[model samples]
Target: MPITSYPFDGQDTTETQYSLLFRELQDTGIADTYGGPSFQVSATGAGMTLSVQPGFAILRGHAVSSTAVETVTLPDAGTSSRQDRVVLRLDPAANSIGLAVLQGPDIGQTQTDTGIYEMSLAIITVDANVTAIDAGKVFDERRYAGSHVGIWTTNLRPVHPRRGRLGCNTTTGRWEYWTGTAWTDLIPGTADNTTRWNGYTLTVSTSTPSGTPSPDRIWIQPTS
Candidate 1:
């Protein structure tokens, strides 16, 4: 049992739950504020700034999708990483070319002295397929044949796109999920959900992952 289990368990393993209760968090709740894409608004490569429609300004996808990235890679392999802490700022009405700024630390490096410098970064307007979402305007994350906005957090932001399902945020190492209306945490190790700790989360030999694990790792016990 942990912070909350009600937020991270449901889906009876035999139901056609159409309500999307397992959409991933588009952005992490950390120091970054990701507000923004259905497609590669800019281009589908490195050094390419992404944009999206107004309402779909922020994007989210399956937490564990193959496209999930830990750090923004540059158009060139060794040129330079977009840096982990850099936040993408956008404003449709800003005159300084898309209200983009260069700030934040370089991750494993000292802070830059740019001091809020503006650049002509990629500008995102709107898309025809994806409907725009206002703050708290509840829309289905997997609705229609369009893209939904999301963040690039460092975990498996899987898109079960259905309601009343369990979800885990690996970065913060917690399990909470959307309850069709709001988010709920499935307090760790509840009832039969027991966790074994031997210096670290241990494992039974011959299982999948066999060794000491990070405390933030999520483990599900199977019932036979």
Candidate 2:
């Protein structure tokens, strides 16, 4: 005849705080089985230490402080068996527990468009001494009808009045000015220079023609 030992179940232990805690852990899948040791225990005088296996899944605990939580990510494993691991640490003083989660590559969609300055939106003003208005630095007539204008001033004297207009090039980033009839390059070349207009004056005169005249010629003046 063979003798068999029966499993022992505690009768005195009622389903109270400790039993409820254990059941909660078991229900959350943190523990392998009911009435079994769920967390590995380490001892310190200050507080208790609990460690759980990675695959055990969800965790629940009361935090004593805010800074008690700490999380760490694991290294990559391989193709078919990729191991995304997360670790949580709890601290007592801060009354908080740290949590971490792992995931795979992201999948989504995207779009794009290419557009340049199509209309004139602003007026750029430079000084007389400026040799050239580099591309994109000054405003042109086409740019005036667009959205915004940029002004580059380089004149030293406060009262000097020879300010120039900002012009644009159709092919590239270049600006020119209209001196009554001809278009003069305000700044030349690819390099942008100062748009300072200094010491230029405009004169205004009204004359009556033999017949009927058109409108009056308004001249702009610069202080000499």
Candidate 3:
């Protein structure tokens, strides 16, 4: 007669008592095989969401939330500015995640030189085991100078005069004669300091010249 097979119910079936053992052995005839720990979740689903955490670390990296996208503002400094929004992604071949500025409103449109320019979310990689790395902290805008200006002068002598020379008053629009290297407030009307003969003509020189000197004459010119 053929053997009868019993149906499997919720009751314990150990009473039937037929032991079965299946083992996978290596070519060296070893019973134990080498294998890594099993994971319940796949590598693609391993990434976790993170928010604005202080200080960068292997576990807690900066990530962009759906509600809040990282933004950088640059004021007009008479040039174009730029802002990069880098995204971190897994690289299986490299065994480490990498950072790339993925999507944004025209990275090239950001001003290159401007007031209060910002570069937000530059990326940094951590390790292979980690799935994703977060964005870097926002760096404030730094001013770069394109041009500058400074005071310049052509006069080599001091503003104050000595001997019979007249001193220049930077405050008032008048030149006063120096009384022994010191400025005299008085304005001499007709005072002769020296006399000379020019082409058999008597020419008197005063502490202050009356009119513009000849082109070859040595005299200090007023400056702006």
**Model 3 clashing residue pairs (backbone):** 80-111, 80-112, 81-110, 81-111, 81-112, 82-110, 82-111
* CA lDDT of each prediction against the hidden true structure: 0.31, 0.29, 0.29
Model 2 lDDT per residue over 1-224, tens place: 98533234753543233433543443222222222232211111121121222222222322112222222222222343222222333333344434332322321111111111011111222223333322233222210111112333232212221123344545444455434444456776643221223542223224322334324422433344
TM-score of structure candidate 3: 0.15
Count of clashes, each model: 36, 36, 7
Candidate 1, 60-146: lDDT as tens digits: 211211223222222221232232212233222341212132322222322122222221223222222333312221121212222
For model 2, the run of ten residues with the poorest summed lDDT: 108-117
- Local accuracy of candidate 3 as per-residue lDDT tens digits, 1-224: 98644335764533212111111111111111111111101112223222321221110111112223222222222222233343333233343432334332354313222111222333223233343332332222111111111122224334533334444454543455445546554464454443333533233433445666564444333442
User: After superposition on all CA atoms, what RMSD does each candidate show versus the true structure?
Assistant: 19.9, 31.4, 34.7
TM-score of each: 0.20, 0.15, 0.15
Better of 1 and 3 by lDDT: 1
lDDT of 3 at 49: 24
Give lDDT: candidate 3, residue 37.
Answer: 15
